[model samples]
Target: MDIQKIRRDTIGCEQLIHLNNAGAALMPAVVANGIRDYISAEETGGGYETADKYSAELDQFYTYMAKLLHCRSENIAFTTNATDSFNRALSAVPFKQGDVILTTENDYPSNFIAFISLQKRLGIEIVTVRNTPSGETDLEDLEQKINTLQPRLVSVTHVPTSSGLVQPVAAIGNITKRYDTLYLLDACQSVGQLAVDAIATGADFISGTFRKFLRGPRGAGFLYISDKALQSGLEPLFPDLRGAEWTGIHAYTHREDAKRFEDWETAFALMAGSTAAIKYLLDIGIQEVQTRNETLTAYLRHQLGNVPGVQLQDKGKHPCSIVTFSIANQEPERFKQYFKQHGVNIYTTARSSAIIDFTQKGIEWVARVSPHYYNTEAEIDRFMQLLTAIA
Candidate 1:
């Protein structure tokens, strides 16, 4: 990869040592410009007119995402963010009283909260699978739970937000397939950073956000509904006109495709921006992006380990770019503020973000520093020096 050329295309590379990619990545100039051009057109013309004019670009969001995820364009639905996408996918599952939704202890917080809500409202049981000693989803235990419980849905976060732990989704998919259970995957942190094949992963429903590793504008996310999911006739709770046609005074027909999960009104500019950002990543190739991300993060982990008082806290059999660690004697807020004041961008994850995982690991909070493909080794070294001094 041409790291120099890629960095040049990124807007904040020169101004800040951006290591908060897991929170929100720095958007590329192409994506920013694409959004700007669309917004400009909207201001010059009208919202509907601009949307009609750039309809192809807006539609390209599905095409690009389909190509990136190895699925049909008809299977994609654009959403406001990852949480919304996940919620839409979850709402489609036919949950009844005493139904089981099996997942990992380290699953994303918002998703777990949704499960809790379901448990309260519908008497659905939220069953958490055991994790391995090394902090990965225990496949053996997961299979056993599936065999015994016959869960209504088996959900897994491809990469949890609070840690760099990557769950074995494909392996879990294999188990879910054997049990004939629906599999939902949250790929918010892994979509652009890794090459994800939706079908190969056996994910009936997958959700992702463009604001993170995809380097796209905020307010843009997507959900992928498999052919099997479409055939299942699963419908989200609330379907707008875009998702369902008002055929009669009290009746409507849901869309045959994944659009049944979408809202009528959307940010066309954000959609255009997502299209450009995904196209840019496709041009670079996901394989190459994954390689660069692993290389840079490996360097980051090695350098961070060398710093005294910096306890490396990532726990996955195959960790990627989202690096988490804690200062030996400093508070998470203070450490985050100190790093920000020193022109090093970073964020912190608290126990609330990963209650089960953090409690199990005996951590109150930790700093999360994520590096993208555009970040350089020198930037990693500079951040390391800052962290060393703080330690």
Candidate 2:
């Protein structure tokens, strides 16, 4: 990896010690310029006119996303964000009364909320699988629950937003496949930073966002639908005009492809930016990016471990770039203020976000510092110096 070239392309890293890639990485010049130019064209040529002129570039988003996930272009659908993608996929599952959704406690908070809402509205049941002592999804317990419960769908988060713990998604996929149950994967924080192959996971549906690790513009995400789901005729319950054709006064046929989960209108400018960002990552290679991320996080973790009064809150044997820790008797907001004052970027995860995880850990909040491949060891060292003095 060309560390200097990567950091040079990432202009924000030059201005600040960026440690919030999991929230939103600094967009490289190509991506930001792509978005700016598209918006400029939209302002001058009109939205519809600009979309027509750049239609091929907009379509390339799906092609690039297919490359990222190792799926056919027809299997990808565009959405507003990862949660939007997940919700659309969830809507496609033909939930009946008393249907069960088996999931993990460390799942994304917003997704768990959606499950609870589904339970209340449709009388669906939600069951959480047990976690191991180190906080990974217990595969043995998950398989046991699937055998006894016969769940309608099995959902898993590739990586939760609060921490860097990467769940054994591929292994869980094997379990879901063995049970012949539908699998939904939330790959919001894992797609660009990890080599996520849809074929290897065998998930029926996978959701991802470009704004996070992909260094793309906001308001754009993509979903991957397995050919199995397409052949089974699964689609969003309320398909839009873009998703289906109106055959008659009261009839419509959904698209044969994954676009059946998409809406009629979208931000074409954001699509242009996302196209550039995904192409950027594809050019660099995901495995190389993952290696760089592991190196940055390993250094960050080692530095944080040595800070007095600092409690490392990350779990799992293989934590990713997100480093979560708390200073003794220090409010999360204080950490935020301190980092802001020092021109260092960081984020905080609160108790409300990860109910089970935070409640069990006996904490209300933790500081999340996520450094991307563009970040340098020097930046991590500078962050450590600031943190050590604060401690």
Candidate 3:
């Protein structure tokens, strides 16, 4: 691996020990500088003129995202963030009265709330599969639910926000395909940390943010809609001129691609930065990055487990880069603040962020420490030493 190139790209290593990659990975120099350059152009040229001047670069955003997710460029749409992308995709699915929407218990709170709100409004039936003993969605229960209910949509988070557990997305995809159910994957945390092939996952729609493991600017994300979805005429709830053409006074035609989910206005500067971020990740090779992240996380977990009074909260047969834990008699916020004071960055997850899972597990809050490929093993050792000292 080109360690020198990686080190040069990431400038944050010198400043702080960042362990919140799942929340927002540190942006590389290229992405930060790209956004600055775009903003400078906007000052010299008018906003509209600047966008026109860099339209090709903005267009490359979709192309780069498509390559990252292994889908066609036409099947990709840029969104404000992962939540925005997820909401848009959910809105596109026409939910009728008595329709069933099946999901896992570990689903993100925002997504769970959206489903409940839609169910109340549309009178749709919402079903949640039982979790495995290990904290992941039980495959047997999921298969049984699909066989019985034949849900209108099958949604699952590739990686839950509260823990390091990675759900069996490929297996779920196989089941969804067998039943011809519309599959939607929430890949907010898994996109850049793991290899996400929309085709292999068999998800008709996939939503993810660039800020997390992608290490891009905030307020930047993308969605993937399979060709089959486009052919089936699925569209956003409010399609604008950019998404659909005004054919006549009372008629219109939606685009033949995933662009139908997008609006006209966007942050061109952020899009440029997102494009640069994607290129940087691709250059490093995602497979190698995933391996590096896994190794770092494993080392962190092992060290944390050895610390007195520190209990790792993540439970699963296979885990990702996220490491959740709690120290005895330590409030989540206080613990996080302690780390912050020591120049270490981490995040706290309250029950509200993942109410269903946390509430069920009797965990009110947890401290999350997530590492990316750029993080070193030495950082993990230092973090462990701090954790031990605190304990």
Candidate 4:
């Protein structure tokens, strides 16, 4: 990977350090320009006319996403964000009273709330599988749960937002497959940063965002639906005209493919930007990106670990690019402001943000520094210098 060329293409590289990629990465020139050009065209030619003209480009977004996800174009549906994509996929599952959603403790907080909502609205049961000492999903406990009590769906987050903990997703997928149960994998953090194959992951539904490692603009994401899921007649409970066609007064037939998960209207400019971002990653190659990320993260962990009063908070057998740590005797807001003052980008994750995991770890909050492959080792060194002076 050409660090110079990568940093040059990223507009903010020279101005400040960006260590909050897991929150949102620096968008490259290709993605920004694509969005700007499309929006400009829409402003002059009108939205409808511009969309009609760039119909092929808009359609090609799905094709690019299909390549990234290892799925067919028909199985991809564009959503607003990872939450929207996950919600759509969750709603599609035909859950009745007493249905169970077996998940892990480190599942996304938003997803956990969604599951709780299901429990309140419907009589759905939410069961959590055991976590290993290192905070990864325990395959033994998961298999035992599936064997003893059947779950309607096995949902797991590929990477938790609170830390660098990488869940054993593929193994969980295998467990779900054994029971012939539905599986939903939250690949929002894993997709662009980590190489994720839908078929290999064995997830019936995969939800992701382009704004993170993919470096696309916000307000745009995509969902992947497996052939078996679609063939089994699963679709979003709230279907719009874009997803289905009305046949009679109160009857409608949803599309056979993943379009049934999307709404009618879409932000074409964002779609254009997302397409360009995915194309950029594909050109660079995800495997190469992963290699670069591993080196950066390893260096970060080592440097941060040695910093006085800095406690490394991330845990997993194989952690990804996200690096979370708590500074003793430092307020989270203070930590956030200190980095901001130094022209560094990072986020402070609160215990409320991830109650289960945070409460278990006994920390009120932690500062998150998520770096991408585009970042330089020199930047990490400077990051350490600034952090060492934090006391």
Q: Is candidate 3 or candidate 4 better by lDDT?
A: 4
- Model 1 residue 232 CA deviation (Å) reads 1.2
**What is the C-alpha lDDT profile of model 3 across 1-391, one tens digit per residue?**
6656776778987789899999999999999999999999999988999998898888898888889888899999999999999999999898899999999988888899999999889999889999888988888999999999989999999999999989989888988888957999999999999998989998989999989999999999999999988999999999999899999999999999898998899888999999999999998889999989889998888888888887789978989999998768888888898989988999999989888778777878888999988888888888888888879
lDDT of 4 by residue, 330-354 (tens): 9888788898899998999999778
The TM-scores of all predictions, comma-separated, are 0.98, 0.98, 0.97, 0.98
Measured on C-alpha atoms, candidate 2 has an lDDT of: 0.91
What local distance difference test score does each model get? Answer: 0.91, 0.91, 0.90, 0.91
- Candidate 2 weakest ten by summed lDDT: 326-335
lDDT of 3 at 314: 93
lDDT comparing candidate 3 with the true structure = 0.90
Give the per-residue lDDT digits (tens) of candidate 1, residues 327-370.
78888788888988988899999999999988877989989999
| Candidate 2 lDDT, 180-228, residue by residue in tens | 6899999999998999999899899999998999999889999999999
lDDT of 2 at 237: 77
Model 3: ten consecutive residues of lowest lDDT: 1-10
Model 3 per-residue lDDT at 19: 92
Candidate 2 local Cα displacement, residue 224, angstroms: 0.6
